[model samples]
Target: MTDTITEFDSILEALHQAIEKSDSAAAIRTLQQADHDQTAKLIDRLSVEDRQALFGLLTPEQGAEVLERVYYFQGADIIEELSAQVAAPFVAELDSDDRADLMNELDQADSEAILEELDEDLAHETRRFMAYPDGTAGAIMYSEFVSFQADMTVEEILNDIQTNRKKYIEFGVQYAYVLGREHQLLGVLPVRNLLFASRSQQASEIMIPKPTTVHADDTIEQLEDIFEEHNYLGLPVINKDGCLIGIIDRESTTEALQEAATEDLLKFQGLMGKEELRSMPLKVRSGRRLSWLSINVVLNLISASVIAMHQDTLEAVIALAVFLPIISDMSGCSGNQAVAVSMRELSLELISPKEFRRVFFKESSVGLINGACLGLLIGSLAWLWKGNAMLGLVVGTALALNTTVAVCVGGLVPLALKACRQDPALASGPILTTVTDMCGFMLILGLASLCLPYLV
Candidate 1:
């Protein structure tokens, strides 16, 4: 096809025709003709089979370009589908951090096989990067940066940068760092200084001594705070021995945050192992979904048992049945809002698990206000429909009380779960739902039973 891929949708038919014909040349030509953004979107939307088919047609250089642009996990999936032999060359073209990311996401067998196929130095470096605990600065830091010994003359460093233009360009010259023999960071030389400094001066003589550094094992939260406070484009990362190893840039930290957010959203949806995709194995998709659905059945049954316990009150006042779900659902919505706020605060480190009293008081104040407002509205509705003041009061009071209970449970349960080191997102929704249902049922039915004489 001579047609250029301007829009992703326009290119799909050509790709399908090429794939169906099993023409690798046509497939690749079609891919090459497509716009870069369209190609990436096309890749993302393809089924696993189509993705593999299309990727298989790409040259190693082309494949590497594809791998680096897609999200890391998404790239890992592509690598996992390819043969270790076919994947390693493309992997070799990636920078150290990106290489480590793809390798880390591979299955053990796949990773080992791919590693074996890679250059010895590259393989070893990949393993070293993988050894960093996930969510630490080391795990996501860029291994590309320009560094020189403190003794190198400005002329010599400038000459070296010019000679290895491609290498330095990839390294992203922000500020040149000076290191000791052991590679301990000694100083930083702002790139602009080279314009004014004497060419004969040694790096240490002109460099700003003892520039800021972060340890490789530092947490991402620490990195976020550092970057936010300083507004620096990048910071040098060192090992426990204080030798420079990598660079932690604003881009890396922001990407880590985005990945964490995606993982949390999945966890909140009850996806086990914190990830799931339709393209994943059918068994994996089924099992992850069933895990939550199965527990939900048990929870729903428990709420039903509460209804069974109050069978007499429900029978006596048939109108109460209409409001049971309304109350539970409305309160559950309020409670989930509290849960969301608590989760956000915890993630931002604004609050800790031990601050139960603080969360309780804040949630209770809102709950009382919202509950009273909601109660009045529902109370008015009940009175108009049923033409009875006592019935309206009973229904309205139950909803109001249940709303308060719901908000408290929603806000507190997340903190309690955090204290126990459990996932608040996974447990909070079900906990809030079940508690609100049982409480709403008890309040309405229990109050109605007490005031039975007046109603009759």
Candidate 2:
């Protein structure tokens, strides 16, 4: 990872200098030395005119290769800048799944125009792949899987594979689907298995019958579960009528899951919808961020209102004011730990939304043990610092109570969101912090108010 970052930084610096000089040839030379992913990263840093200039320096095939390495939204932005005549051929050369993804990111009119420019057959195939709902297994699966009839002899299948070696290589063939009548999926034959089989053996005799399968409409989460349980290189995707439609390769599944995880991380950090080019206009980036930040402002005000309610208590015992942030911030940290665990459990399907009660009790137990230990330690320090027993008790008790509440709220909120068909990580940081702050303030100040005479 460190090496990759260093390489990216080096490439980015070189590209910046070349673009600054308006040296398209130098830029092209630098880009040619970099791989597709490196090129994609550099392209994102380029100004719109520079990006166009860079693309002009490459042939359509080189442009397509770099575009393929870029994320869907970034690729769409780049494609939109090109003329239809220039963009269409590039789009047509993309893998079917990638082409569909890019088109989906584009506006309907733009997508249609580009589709028209593609060859009739390629356009039809791209449209079919795009027909699946976003986030389903079908949407991400490749349609280039190799299949053989169950009755085909091993020799015959081998001959066909050798004949279309390039196509199989492009498809990343890991397994061959065995089909019955009407192209119904009968079994799966791993390529490794075929190598050991006799030349005279039939596919049906060697194939693994009733292989685990997923429907086209199955959610990516469901696909994740299947992938976790089985170590197959690819899983056959079937339609409602039980005929094979496509195959979901393990690499694609891994990539989708990783992207989902990254997205969740971004949403957790309140950075939603900001996955765009760094060269994106400042106003657009600010707008995307401000939507979430603005919502957070209102949410945080609720925590502030709690402090306002106890203004008198704060003024009487300024030390309590000093500890307010410490208590709240510490509890918030603990709560985030619980949130991380719950999010992982939810994503991995280790627990269901309905299992919230079980997770609640488990996290609460953890909170109780951790809170008691932390509370005692902080309470003793308060006594030594202020020489006030009541102040010690108030701060310590408040910390303990707030810690328990924080863990419970943290664990439950994500599950609650999942239950409501929402992203579990959506604004979770602000929501969790708000609740922890409000609860911590109420506990510390309310206690201080009751013992004001002793504190003073």
Judging by TM-score against the true structure, name the best candidate. Answer: 1
lDDT of 1 by residue, 304-406 (tens): 8988988987888888889989999999999999999999888777899999999999999999999999999998899999899998899889989989989
**Where does model 1 exceed 4 Å of error?**
1-6, 17-29, 32-37, 45-49, 274-283
Each model's lDDT: 0.85, 0.85
Q: How does each model score on TM-score?
A: 0.89, 0.86
Q: What 10-residue stretch in candidate 1 is worst by lDDT?
A: 1-10
lDDT for residue 88 in candidate 2, whole number 0-100: 93
- What lDDT would candidate 1 get against the real structure? 0.85
Prediction 1 TM-score vs. true: 0.89
Q: Over the stretch 302-376, how does candidate 2's per-residue lDDT look in tens digits?
A: 999999999988988999988899889989989999999988888667889898789889999999998888888
Model 2 CA deviation exceeding 4 Å by range: 1-30, 83-85, 107-109, 119-124, 131-136, 153-159, 192-202, 219-230, 274-277
